[model samples]
Target: MVSGSGVFVFDSSGKDYIDAVSALFCATLGFHNERLIEAATRQMRELPVYPTALNRTVPVVHALADALSAAAPIPDAHVLFATTGSEAIETLIKTTWYINKQRNPKRHKIITRRGSYHGSTIFATRLGGIESIINSFDLTGDDILYAAQPRWPRDALAGETEEDYAHRLALELAELIDHTGAENIAAFLCEPVSIAGGMYPAPKGYFEAIRNVLSMRDIPLYFDEIVTGFGRTGKMWGSQTVNQT
Candidate 1:
């Protein structure tokens, strides 16, 4: 029903509208970009296709991997490329499971927030906290857990300051960890800015407090930046925007 150019989509009758959604938040550079077209054309001309698995990689893939790894927040962090956000999320979940299985097989549970939308994949859907999506699918699992979203406006108590709200949320997370048993948790996953969930940024100090709790318990923290990455938040990364590290 829609066709178009950068930031503007035209209907069949030629009525154009701004594509504010940006193709599910992936096309941050907009559509029909000549630079992207040229890049793709050049790459196709050089190497049309190559498998990335089993150490088979093209020059462009290596270059991109190097760039992303260099830009990663963690020191000496490696990069794993996936075709989609959902695949990347699945990779994260599997990676966490692998690590926890080595340490303590029972510590495979992942903690996410209510209203979060991870993906449509079976395991990913189970990890997502959106009720409607989960209800639509028979994603039965007990390894994923949900926590309250850090939405200050909706969840904050009367007259509570932002800092207090953040602390309260942190306490709630601590309590959840306690109830669930830190030993049973592999990682805590969330978005720096919850866009699809509710379009709300975490209150100041919210991530910091969460990080403190997770660190104390030695639980890894994973940031789903598929929607918030690449300057959507006016920063190179959402973690930077939210002062997560």
Candidate 2:
């Protein structure tokens, strides 16, 4: 449990424990921020609950969106609010399908790396492609395709450099797209730095190589910044850290 004053947690014995996970990595401002409290108080005094849908734009909502977009690297970044990361993933999946449908109706498949975790929701979990989760829930579906994860500890062969591993993975993606017919593929979605898929700092030339392969067939490279965004990797955006932008 987190106290509003930066005090973290208390055991049954009444001893405090420092928050290690830091509220699912979301509390960048830390616990018990007075600013947050003041904002909440002010908003509660005005309008406590408001739905963003149905063409409603509350002042706080607009301010928050503007702040988020200002921080976003894209020139005209769009913001969509959701209760959880799972919801965000769901939104992403829908947005991907929507964008692809607008561009090419045939493109419907989403290529994600094995062992990656977007969220626990059905669509995100299906995109995750973990064997244990897939076996337990039968999540492997036709719409989501899996690619080999660049797990250096398990994947690198004897005498292979990290660059070589990255190249091989990119090549594998290309081969899969070729076999699957690139025209039918919608996007290659991956975390800029593989986090729960094992916190792998991207190998050198990884993003560029993969981008090159995906770009050849007009496939979109959807960087899952849920983990690596907001200076977690010491940059404003992970794409900026990896020079993907």
Residue 214's lDDT within candidate 2 is 94
The digit string of per-residue lDDT tens for model 1 on 28-94 reads 8888889999999999899899888886888899999999888877788889888888899999889
lDDT of each: 0.87, 0.84
Best by lDDT: 1
- Model 2 stretches with alpha carbons more than 4 Å out: 2-8
lDDT of 1 at 105: 94
lDDT of 2 by residue, 1-245 (tens): 32433637566666787776556777766687889889889989999998888887898899989999999888899999888877887898788789878878889999999989988887888888677987898765698889987887577889889899889989999999999999899888988888888887778888899999999889989888887787777898888899988
Model 2 C-alpha lDDT versus the unseen true structure = 0.84
lDDT, residue 234, model 2: 85
- Give the range of the ten consecutive residues with the poorest summed lDDT in model 2: 1-10
